[model samples]
Target: MPTSSPQPPPPADGLLSAARRNLREVAHGLTHASHPPTPLFADAPRPWQRLLPYGVVLALAATLIPVTINFLISEYGVPGGVAGALGVAQAAPLLMLAHRPLQAWWIVFPADIIGALVLLGYPVATYTVWPWTPPAIVGYLFLLLALGLRETRRTSIAVWLATGAAGVVLHVISPGRSNGSALLLPVLGAVVLVIAAAVRERGDAQRRLAEQETISEAERAQRTLLEERTRIARELHDVVAHHMSVITVQADSAPYRISGLSEEAVEEFGSIAASARESLAEMRRLLVVLRSDGTEGERAPQPGLDRLQQLVEATVRAGLPAELSLAADLGDVPQTVDLSAYRIVQEALANVVRHAPGARTRVSIASDGEHLTVVVANDRAERLGSPLEPTGTGHGLVGMRERVRLTGGTLDTGPLPDGGFRVAARLPLSPASPSSLEDL
Candidate 1:
């Protein structure tokens, strides 16, 4: 049998350790967790809103003091000085609560005890020690709410319990003219505490909710920006892929088209074509990631001048009658130029579809051997359907300008005098090297 290790001896200062643990628990229980304080009248409340609370409370305090003093002087026959002083003590603390709530709380109980004794001792004891008189009730209600707003629940509970104990002592020692109000005061105090707690909790919840909404809005803006960047990247990838495809085609057919003499020349051409094809393949994989829908199959090729007819036909089918005209020999144009030329028309036509619905559109492409020009013009809509809404935010023209710029091109777009819109782009037909295409 394996021998068990001896148990550690109890702490030498076991009693002291237990006492420390008990003190920690007591402190934790007494000190309630709290957040940054939110005053009922905030630090920077509007002038009117801030003044309203102070004005209302001061008015109540003013009214309560005079009425209580008059009652004491007329009915209880207390000295004028004593009545006035007691009334001031009871009501003055309420005024202090306007600025310093917790400090005001400390003053209320002492004022009440003094007022009750002055009334009971001199006059024939009309009411109990802590009677729920109108003035007393109003004062307690205000103090309870102010304390709940500015302090923690533990502090409020401690005050509430202490008030109840004081009332109990008053009832036992000198039960006076009426005990009914004595019972009512604590019940009403409990209700006021509940309402104050509810209000404070609601304020905390609203603050938390507002914070969450702000975070969500920021996240949404960031997501929109990322999506726009991805779209731009995908378009540039199309530009790169188009050039790479052309390089592959030209390299493969070089030896066959140019009557090459050396076998080494043929092998070199074959290597160039193979490398171009591999680069194109890698770019296509990246495109898949950019435009992923979880399908692992070949995507259709990027559109060029050859697909102009198909695009026009599709536009017609979508209810925007469009006409296409190729005025120059676009067949010999470089692939990047061909692609930019196509996208310019495509975006312009899309804009026509969106902004000038039911308008006749003309797409024209021309090349002067050095530059390729594309023009897409539309007339004002004769029959306006609801204009097509873009899937992305309003960056359509910005995207067009960017595409033209990347291809060493210029774009001009504006409204025409005929109440229509025109978009034109001229792309340089510079023949980029295969290595440059690979880098793109």
Candidate 2:
């Protein structure tokens, strides 16, 4: 293999091009009007809290303006008019510091340079701080603090470098002059800028965390809703699909069961049987889509009110003292109503066990021919034990509401006045035809 030729030395033009691009970027950042005003106490809850920042700024400006004007006029022997103008230029920017820091800096920086140049022409005390007066330094520090809070780190760094460069120029033009301010301003300004930038970074991190938490909550709720719907579909499929299958079988056997049936009667029964079978096939396909996975559905029959006694007995065994009172005559309850009532009671009891362990619980079922009502109430926990399971995903109430809605029913659930909980559901005995499932 041939040895690779040594890479040519980096071109001087490349370095110059990079420097020019950086300068243009810095100029754009300083001059651009795109930066929005940064609000003080943006998350303050009350009006008084929001107005507090303005009060502080007003006080600072009052003190700085008079002091600055006196210093420029008396110490530096400047004329009253010129000293007043420079003082106002330096102090007024503090008022704009909270909202428009960059603009304020633009005004104050030049004013400081001009004031220094004017004072240079006159005799000054050797002990006096030159270039940057005390009040002027304080005002610029405030401006830099706001700039760090509002602007990006890149912009902030550029601003700091510019300030240092200006200080350097002032020192060069007046060599041997007392240059304490030239050294002091840049060092102090750097500290203030660093602290303000750190605070801003922390606040941004917290806001992003809060937003992520909100998004996670929404996603969890959506997932719970889908799960509840899928479960409802599975139970109803077991109930309704069985009935459809029965209808198909009965229709097929009708002609054979009866004696001397006519041709027209036989043809009608055949049509009914065919329609029932087609409907069952379509329903199964719909169920497949509803299921979360391709696994087989529950093979066991869905529970109904007939299983309430066994469920209560199991609850009692599971550390919950419970009693059940069911009406003797429910008057041939519809299968949907029966299943929903059972599920509602089951979920309510489970909630009691999870949230209020060893609580006194009462489960009652009553019917008045038109509707069946289920109520599960528990007093405050008599004793707390390790829960039967870890805290649940808070979907119990959501499932109950969904079941009641499907059966044309109403649910009422809330904490009782005695620091207990109650879940009551009323399911219609004769619900309207389920048009919701017609597509299936």
Best by TM-score: 2
Instruction: Encode model 2's per-residue lDDT on 148-172: one tens digit a residue.
Output: 8888787888889988888889899
- Give one digit per residue, the lDDT tens place, for model 1 in 98-125: 5666666667778886766665665455
Predicted structure 2, TM vs. truth: 0.83
Q: Which residue runs of candidate 2 sit more than 4 Å off their true CA positions?
A: 1-38, 45-52, 70-84, 178-180, 187-191, 260-268, 281-289, 292-296, 390-394, 433-440
TM for every model, in the order presented, reads 0.63, 0.83
Clashes of 2: 0
Candidate 1 stretches with Cα past 4 Å from truth are 1-51, 96-99, 126-133, 172-182, 249-275, 294-440
Worst 10 residues of 2 by lDDT: 431-440
Whole-model lDDT per candidate? 0.74, 0.85
